[model samples]
Target: MKRMIYSMAIPLSIALSANAQDTIPPDKLYGELFVDVQMNRIFPDGKTFVDCTAKRSPAAIVEDYTKIKKAPTADFSLKKFVEDNFDLPLAPSDNYKTDKNADVQTHIKQLWQVLKRNPDKTVAGSTLLPLPNSYIVPGGRFREVYYWDSYFTMLGLEASGETAMIENLVNNFSWLLSQYGHVPNGNRTYYLSRSQPPFFSLMLDLLAKKSGDKVYAEYQRPLQSEYDYWMDKTAPTKHVVKMPNGDVLNRYYDQYETPRQESYREDVELGAKANEAVKKARYRSLRSAAESGWDFSTRWFADGKNISTIETTNFLPVDLNCLLYHLEITLSKSYKATGDLLRANLYTQIAEKRKTAINKYLFNAADGWYYDYNISGKALSNSMTIAGITPFYFALAPKERIEKAAGIVEKKFLKPGGVVTTLKNSGQQWDAPNGWAPLEWMAIKGLEQYGKNDLAKEIAKRWIDLNVKVYKATGKMMEKYNVENIDATAGGGEYPSQDGFGWTNGVLMQLMKEYPTP
Candidate 1:
C-alpha cells in the first residue's frame, strides 16, 4: 500500500531546458514545494508531483522556476511543467467498463490486458527511480511497480497464460537487485531506505515451476544478495534480532528515522503531537510498519488503537521469519540444483534452525495460535491476525498445530465475506472489516496445504464473491474489501480505496481457476 501525495494541475507558460542535472535531494524537493503551496490544492487528495517520474526532475522544476521568479507573470504550473518536460506512462484502456450482465471471469480477463504496463525504458528523473524490465503496477495512484504486490499479480498472469509478462516481472525484480542493494518498497527513490516483505524467493520459485530448476541457477546470486541485505551485520540492520533463546530471527525495520516522503503531512502532524524525545522512534516505527506491508495495522500498535503507539521494531514478527525461512529453503534448493552440495547443506541447516526457532518463539500453546514475539517484553502479542496462518502457507506448521490454528481461524477470523485481516476491528486498513487480496490468498492456500480444502474453498468462494459484487457495483477492483459488510466500500485508510488494482485481479483470477463454480 503506497502513500497518497497530492499533485496539482497548475497551468503556467514557462520555458526551460529539458536536460537538467538529476541531483536534487528528494526530501529537499518535497519540503520546498510543501512549504510554498498547500499541497492539497495543487494535487487532489491522492495525487502527488513525485508520482510523475517519467517527465521532469524536482531539481529541474525548482531550478528553472527560481530563474524566472523576477518576471511578474511567471506563474508556476506543475501540470504545464510536467507536460513540457516529461512523457507520461500509458494508462489502462477505459474500454473495459464493467459488464454488469457478464460473468465475473469475463470481466477479469478484460482487466488482465487493461492493467498491463509495457516495459519502461525511459529513465526516471532524480525524484523517481527506474526499473530495467517492463512490469505491471498495482494500479490507481500506484503508477510504479511494487515489491510484494508483483508476486500475487504473477499468479493471475500465470493463470491468464501470460508467461512472458511473468518472466518480465521476475526480470524487473532481478534488475532492481542488481542496481540497488535491495528492492525498495516500490520503484521510488524515496523508498530506498527500506523494503516491503521479501517475496523475491517466492517469485523465483513460481517462475521456476514453468521455466525449470535452471531458472534458480540463474537467479541464485540475486537471491543471495537479497538475503544478505536482510541479514547484514551492521548497525543499520535493526530488523535482525538475537532472541533470549539464542536464535536469530527477523523483525520489520526501516533505516529512515523521519517522516516518509509520500506521507509527509500525516507523519509530521502525528509527530508534532508526540514528545520530542520519541519523535525519531515513532517515525521509524511507522516506516517499519510500511515495510511490513501492513502499513497502519493495529497489529503493530502498542495500544492496538492509536497509530502513535506503533512499536513494530519491538517485536519479532512471525510473518517476516516465515518468509526468511522460505528464502532459506529456496536458496538451499537453488544451490542443490546448481550442484553446490556444501552450500545447499549449509542453507538446509539454516532453514531447519529457523523452522525450530519460529515454532519455539512464536507458537502460543494456550491460545492454539501463533503470535509475534515482543523481544523487549518477552511476551507474545495478543492480536489475532492473518499472519498466524503464514506458517501453514510455507508448510512449516505441524499437522496438530495446523488443525488447531485452522479451528481458531474459522471460529474467530472468518467473516461472511472472507477471513478478516484481524479479529480486532481497529480503524486501520489492515484490521477487521477489511480483507486484503494477498492475505486472502495466503489464508486459502495455507489451509489447502494441510488438506483443509473444504475450508479453503469456502474462504475462496466468499472472497471471490465479494470481489465480484464490488466490481459489478463500481466497475473497479479495490485495494482492499470490507468483508464484514459486502455492500459497503472499504474505509479507514489515509486515502480513498483505489482501482486499477493488480493483486486483486491476480488473486481473484487464480482462485476462480482453482475453484470454479459448476
Candidate 2:
C-alpha cells in the first residue's frame, strides 16, 4: 500500500488563491433594513425574513428602503413591500405528505429525497453561502446544512447505503472549511459569527470507514484548519481557555456580541429591559449558547430559571471539550496513517493532555457524573445535564468513573420514554421532558462503551418505541420528543416542534436496524 502524505503548509497558499472570502454576516450586510424588519416584526418568525431571497440586489433593496422609509406614502404597506421584494423561506417538507401506514424505514427512505438540497445557485442577495455539493438539511425551517446535525444524519445515510451522498456531504463541509477559516453553524451568511459543535473530524472518520484511509489525507488540510480555528492562540481567553493550573480547555463562543440575525426579535424582546452593558452581556451569552446547539437550557443560566440570567461564556462545557479531544485523537490517527511520526506524536500528546484536563476539571467522582466548570468562579457548574456522558462516548472516562456515571444516568436521567435532556424543568426545549435524537444516541453509545448494555438496550428500545408511536399518531417525525409523557407533544421552544426532522429519522433508522423487532 502506498502511504499518501499531506503537507501541513499548503492551506494558507490554497486559501489565498481560492477567490473566496469569509461572508459578511447578514446583520452587517443588510444594515438598518435588517434591524428595522426584525424589530418591527415584519414576519412572524425573525428567521423567515433573514432567510428570504431578495428579488433585487441587497444593496439596491437597502437603498430603496432608506429612501422610501424617510418619506412614506399613505398606501404603503411593509408586508406588501417585503412580499414584492423577496421570496419568503419555505419549510423543506411543506410540499410532501407522509404515508401513515408505510413501514418506518420505507417512509424515511422516501423522505430523504424531499429533504435533500442540491448545489445552490448564486443568488444575488441570498444569505446562503453557496455550496458546491448536494447536502441534507435537518428539515422544516432548517433549510441549510448544519455542522453537528449532519454527522448523526449520516449515520442513517450509511445504514441506507447512501455512500455517495455521505461522500458528497463530507466534501461540502471540507469546502466550507477550506474556503472560510472554519465551518460556520450552517452554510448561511447569518451563521458566520459562530460555529456549532466541532463534528468535522467525526464526519471525516465516518467517510474514511466507507472510503479508504486516503480519505483522511484528502481532508487533512480541513481537519487542521478546523482544529486551528478552535485553538486559536491569538485569543487564548476566548474559545481556547487556560485554566488556573495552566491546563488548556475550550468553551463555546461567537465572534459578534450583537443579537443573532435569525432570532433577532426574540433576543431583542428578552434583552429589552436591561441596560446597554447588561444587554450586551446577555446577547453574548445567548450567542455562545447558540453555538453549543443546546441553544436554550438551564445549563448556561446563572439563576437556572431564566434566559436573562445566562452565563454561557463563564463555563468550560464538558461536551465541547470531549469533542475537541476526539478531534485531537482523530488528527493523531490520521498523521500515523500517513507515516508522519512527528506530527502524530504531537497530536497524541495534545489528546493525552486534553484527556487529563477533562478528568481534572470536568469529572465529579463523589457525585458520580461530570459537569461544566465555571471558569470565572473556579468551581464545577451546578447544572447536571446529559452532556456529562460525552467522555464515555469517546472512551476517555476511567473504568471506575464510568460505572458511577452510568449509575447516575440510569437513576436520574432515565425516564419512561427515554432519557430527558436535563433534570431541570426550565421551560427550555433542551431541558426536562424533551428527548433529542442526538443526546439519546450519545447516551446509548456511551452506555454501551462501558459494558452497560442492558441500560443501553433499554434506552434504544424505549426511544424506538416512542418514535414509532408518534409516527403512528401523527404520520410525521419530530425534531424532539417529550420523553416524560409518551402521549403528549414536545413543546417549549422559541418555535413550534418541527416536523420532517432529519436527526430523528436518522437515529430511528439506525436503532431499528440494530434492535429489530421479531
* Highest TM-score scorer: 2
Off by over 4 Å in 1: 1-25, 34-41, 53-57, 63-96, 99-101, 123-126, 233-235
lDDT of 1: 0.78
Candidate 2, residue 22: the lDDT equals 32
Expressed as tens digits, the lDDT of each residue in 303-420 for candidate 2 is 8888889889999999999999999988888788888989999999999999999999898767979999998889899999999999999999998887788888889999988999
Q: How much is the lDDT of residue 488 in candidate 1?
A: 85
Model 2 segments more than 4 A misplaced: 1-22, 233-237
lDDT of 1 by residue, 258-282 (tens): 8777777677778997787688899
Give the CA lDDT, 0 to 100, for residue 56 in model 2.
79
TM-score, candidate number 2: 0.95
Any idea what lDDT model 2 has? 0.85
Cα-based RMSD of candidate 1: 7.0
